[model samples]
Target: MPLTPIKSDDPVHLAMQGLFPDYNPACLEPAQDLELLRGMLRPRSSGGVKGLVHRSFQGVTRRCPRPLRELLLGLAHRLRCADPELLKEPNQCEFNRLVAGVRSQGSRQRGYAGKRAALCLSYDVDLLSCYRFLPTLLDQLDQRGLKATFHLLTDWEYRLDPALVEEVSARGHEVGLHGASHDVALGYRRDERIAGELRRALRGLGKNVHSYRAPALCMTERLMARVRDLGFRIDSSLPMSSMFHPSTQSCFPYPLEPSGVLWELPILLQDSTLFLDLGLSQEQAWSFVETHLKQVLELGGVGVINLHPSWAAKYSGFHGRLLDAAREWSDFAVMTHKEVYNCCRWGGAAPSAPAC
Candidate 1:
């Protein structure tokens, strides 16, 4: 698909306006804005005051007077939050006018072609143990005739079998690049270093890899641009919730303006955050997924779900139940990430085959 200028009232355009009321696409450089927002949203490690003080003072703070230590840590956090390097606001009035002009032109664009809602199953294979469950997972998906996209990590400690990767592609599923080594700090890397890492991972993955997801869903604008320049067709890294807070960005796929050529498949929900991070029970997590699926379908948007293979292996019963529910859902098309991106891009007919 070719990159085209987004119309003023496109959903993505409006969503961007809604997200950063002060955002001005024309006034601000895409890389600068994206980097600023990235730094603002990047997740922070959980640490207590003592932990912070120790790290900041290099272990000397632990021996300092308790009151002095507390004071130092408080000032440090306050200074960090007020850092000028982190805050940059774009022109909101111009952005609003831009989106309003587009909205005035026509209705917002729907994410899926033929106005059909879609459900995309995305798996991030981060560990070697995760690879062992692929056959079973593939068999289950094949039985249901549901397509999926697998994001493989190439630079991890263990090696991924190239033969297995080829087998996945042969089964009509999509294989996407995760990262070179699953680095959580990848978003903070310099542009040159980031490009080199991506190139290395792409080379390791062999040919025909067209999609990417940042490690831990942490991404910067430079990283995205490099990915596009590197020949990726889509990115599935943005999320509704980031390291700092939940975002108001749409959960549908949309063209990332400035970097207009690459499509973004924003994750609607993730199993790891829901189950492991948030401490939601398996039943509750699946229920949350079902709820979001129905809501997105009603709005005619795509719902991209992230499920790690290692977690699936551990919670096989829960994973199986979720897939079973997905197979039975008739309103949405269950497809791979690439299929959904293509359908949204070319405005093609909806899938005619029954989801089951």
Candidate 2:
């Protein structure tokens, strides 16, 4: 008299199967279905899913819609009743092959991509040590046949001898903005204040300021939007390290929401993070950089190294070791953040930049 429950293989079951085709109704009991339905009514967790589900959900979230999100939350609950051995055991050959296929494709981009690296030689102009070391650092870069983007603070430029700015530009280096003043709590400041700081920094550097890295490596979504509004093309504050990596997927070098004009190039490694955050010796730090750079280069991906002028001056032979290590790798084009963004392909943007 009553309609029969559909089998997982039945056509009717396809509508509720969600993302994966192998998901089967046979794997779930009637009690599991009731539990899943109940979970659907609960609010989504603020921190998102937990544990292995967190890893599983990353792939799922990128493409999931609001309705699909609810469906997935429910589906996950039902899926838990699946055979423990099936879930816990290493994937079968077909699944492993599928994973390998995706990984190989993702990695292939890094390998034929050309070798390019950007050395951002920056000064938080407010720092007195930076003033002393910047000139020396510029000379060193000249000898090494390298150039950098100098993100300067406007108000503090007077502290450095005036000729130094011209000398840096003369030697083929770039001067951009740090901020008008180095606010100790810059990131925690209000949005308008931050924008004002950027404007003041730009005004001090003269109008040629087009690229920016945040003071203290602190950037919020609002700050990024303000940067775009100000006509800057790139943001270099994104962290490439595991601990400080951007909290959201949007931080990766790609198109933005509003203008689609701004590009975010994450700093793969910074000198300070090695010296201060990790308390690693320069040699130890160089080892980490070498390993990461080799991996990225072998895969054909962008490798960015941010070196502070102060550190290079303080640590004897550190800068030389960094340059020597770079010489061992092949097919890398080292440029500034602005150069990379202008040349890098984002969405429809053409990759006109050369392999320098």
Candidate 3:
């Protein structure tokens, strides 16, 4: 008689079931098993008093006396390490499995043969300052022969310049909706209102808008359903970090399940969280990005990097160096979000569509 194969009942396996309900357990390899173990053993966020301590310590560690600061930083780091919200690597095994599923689907649909890994550069144009640096950012990308996606905030406090939005599209870059406003609570908005606002914003962006990213990475299932209803094909609002929201599960693109219409390309690295929140120096932040990129490539996953134009302008030299490094890094294909979505959704040859 043939031996029965074991179906895991472990929490990690259960979580994976929730994330990729269609995935085959037989696809679970030794490496992925190890990754799941690591994820399980890692620290998780406890959103009560422990979370408060983590936040408070993180806030004042820099200002403490040198020796005290060292102690505080160390303690905070340990606490954060335990925060289940954080991930050692953005592309966990389960998420990678889903990516594999998409790749397989694409191959079947269109016989798609593309790079094993992809690096997507994305910008959240929420601040007015972003517009000021847009020209230079575009120029840098052009010089390097790189493509990026710029997600624009349409109904923010400062009126959006349609000309600037058009310029982004006119160039070879992709444009995506960043939300009607930079509201932190945008995700919690009533469904009808959310749909109305998003629809209006999409209309303003014209026909090229196929992607969206919620303001501040604040997204809920209801919000995603609204996004799909509004006709956006892809969303990049999910982050690998649980610090933003507890439900963020993957760093790879997966159909927003149940609805199964919209694809979510999670942010693998976010500049604001690294620089503003974690207080990493420019060099340190870039170093983290390089490490994450290398890890993503090693795992054969997509690395979606979110860099804000406002922050880039503040550290132009650093941003320039990072772009230069990305250009030099040839191990993975660098693509715009739209191109990746096309391949993921329709299974065609990697698009060589004009960036504009």
Q: Which candidate is the best by lDDT?
A: 3
List model 1 lDDT by residue over 1-356, tens digit each.
Answer: 23345455344443454333244445333434444343323323333452343334535544556467547644544443223232111112222233334434443534443445788889998756677778788888889887899999876745878898888988989898898776655555578988899888877887567678987665666676687777777788876443332232445566564333467777777786666555678788787677777666655567788998778878777788888877887777887877776666545543332110
Error in Å for residue 310 of model 2: 1.4
RMSD of each: 10.9, 16.3, 8.7
**How much lDDT does candidate 2 score?**
0.51
TM-score of each model, paired residue for residue? 0.69, 0.62, 0.71
Report model 2's TM-score to 2 decimal places: 0.62
User: Where does the lowest 10-residue lDDT sum fall in candidate 1?
Assistant: 86-95
Model 2 misplaced stretches (Cα beyond 4 Å) = 1-103, 106-126, 156-162, 242-252, 345-356
Task: State residue 260's C-alpha deviation in candidate 3, in Å.
Answer: 4.8
TM-score of 1: 0.69
Give, for candidate 2, the lowest lDDT window spanning 10 residues.
86-95
Q: Which pairs, if any, clash in model 1?
A: 8-102, 9-102, 22-92, 43-243
